[model samples]
Target: MKSQRHRITDLRTRRRELQRRAATYRASKGTPYPVEVHLLLGQTYLDPASWDALLHSRGPAVALRRARFAPRYDQLLRRLEEAITRYERP
Candidate 1:
């Protein structure tokens, strides 16, 4: 039974961490794609679409079920991870 404020704070913290990682990656590789992808992911985590879906889900059981069926959630996360991995390669 986490409070909404805590959840929002967690999301913000995750976004900030992603941005920091993106900055580090950009500094190391001198590329914009990794930065762009990380920023996009951060934005996505804060977007209304995500909040609306989260709000609709409510309880833990329903939230898990909603996550399993959410159309773009997994795809977007996977794409972000793939982009980061590609950037990490020499």
Candidate 2:
């Protein structure tokens, strides 16, 4: 069996890879999957400053912009699929 420290290290590596992937995707596409965007937006809302930024940026006026995220949704689905595959690869 792996040591607990090793498992924790592996998890951190995986998280770093995921964030790297997200950054690469964002750099190339200027946006990410809708699910990713949703997650980010949720996280943002949980912060006072980010929530204030969103509230003052466009709010309901730009909500329709979110509907145009089919490509990003596809990207997120691919990431989710990969995560599932990895988890099941015992």
Candidate 3:
């Protein structure tokens, strides 16, 4: 009845608040790295062998080039994963 309606209204408000927080986070902390490269690095994190092979086929120097940014990508992934966990919490 009235209690149920109030519960629903409260949930909707919470949802809107979470959405706003996510939008603000994205605006302020968006990654400067290329999306394609980020996705590829994600896959690399998951499957090192496949990434190694792909990079190997591309060129020997390619891995060296990416090595410079490996730490940065790792940091970015960790931050993104933590953000996702926070967003998923009730």
Give the top-scoring candidate (lDDT).
1
Each prediction's TM-score versus the true structure: 0.48, 0.40, 0.35
Pairs in clash, predicted candidate 3 = none
Query: Per-residue CA lDDT of candidate 3, range 1-90, in tens?
Result: 343324333433443454455556556777343354335334424244644443444454654544544455446555554554454454
| Residue-level lDDT tens digits of model 2 in 9-79 | 44334444555665566577664455644464333222445334423445554344333332353355556
State in Å the error of residue 19, model 3.
0.3
- The most accurate candidate by TM-score is 1
Q: Which stretches of candidate 1 lie over 4 Å from their true place?
A: 34-42, 45-82
lDDT of 1: 0.60
Model 3 whole-model lDDT (C-alpha atoms)? 0.46
* Residue-wise C-alpha lDDT for candidate 1, range 1-90, written one tens digit per residue: 655535544554555665577668889879776565856666456566755656555778756655453435445555665666677677
Query: Clashes in model 2: which pairs?
Result: 33-72, 34-72
When 2 and 3 are scored with lDDT, the better candidate is 3
Residue 27 CA displacement from its true place in model 3, Å: 0.3
